[model samples]
Target: MSMPTLSAQEISSGRVVLRKAHDADRSGIIELFTDPVVRTYLGGPRPRRDVESHLDTSGIENATAKPGSYVIARNGTDRLIGTLMLARRPADRPGHVTDDRDELELSYTLRREEWGAGLAFEAAMAALRAAAAELPDQPILVVTQTANQRSLALSDRLGFRHVCVFEEFGAQQSLSVARLHSFAS
Candidate 1:
């Protein structure tokens, strides 16, 4: 089944426009991943071919088949300032009976220059809003290296509670999770 196309808005921050990524955003996305500061938190600069592969594999057409994903704040000029992904929990092992599909994993990276500008928080909040509306019943999660102070701070600011610590990708990591409760009433 095809997913609905998400609408992108020009979110204003004084004079900046934080919107979604588009077809012409490849080069800007590549630059964000290649920056040293960004690579420090995320493993390393992913190979160019690998990035190209990701773009091809996770395009808008595949958004519904998997958990939704998006690029960072874009302007009317079509510049990419960050990236984010929300993936559904994987299926259980063959013999395991416990599988929670109502959970999603999130990861994001922003241009080094944009650090501390609140763009990351803005982008994350946008994703959370979209997910709550589009994928109800699922809680959102963010796992980061324990030493990644920036991400840990962002998680705390966004209301993700620390749940556990685990080792993964050869590094000690903290797993945080949060529920999306409706406060509309």
Candidate 2:
């Protein structure tokens, strides 16, 4: 059978909803890559013109084109606040929990204004729970830059244990792991 997945699934929780990107999310998705604070650990913000150059309505939904890709928005509205992804760690990427396979990786980013309200954590938990409920039991990974204390703290709060440190994107990074089964009800 094909692997169980969150591919194109619309998931929601009390405060956040993880849904496919849409036309209304274009500006928010652009802001995610162009805003300085939001892209601080993500190779710094791309030039706004450069970021805007490649996007069109079709490109917005490109964020959710694959299984596990989602635009994080408020529960009752389409306004985008952030992005969350529960997908494979590319084999070419530095961090991996398994030798022969690309492990599921959790990555997220939120609008700076929404940072202190626990929205990132809320969005992540919602995605993780959804993935765990559908996918096979396996190790999920969280790789964050060492300088990003906020992300590392969030990983801890989500129950991932630090595994190692490695260099990526010109900086030291930390890798952590949590089993998929742990999130299942």
Per-model TM against the reference: 0.73, 0.94
Least lDDT summed over 10 consecutive residues: which range in candidate 1? 93-102
Give lDDT tens digits, candidate 1, residues 74-150. 54555677777666544441111124433567678888888888878877776666656554444567889999999
Best by lDDT: 2
Q: For residues 54-86, could you state the per-residue lDDT of candidate 2 as single tens digits?
A: 775347667788888898999876679999988
lDDT of 1 at 54: 82
Name the runs in model 2 displaced over 4 angstroms: 1-4
Q: Candidate 1's error at 9, in angstroms? A: 11
| CA error at residue 147 for candidate 2, angstroms | 0.5
- Taking all chains together, the TM-score of candidate 2 against the true structure is 0.94
Candidate 2: what lDDT? 0.86
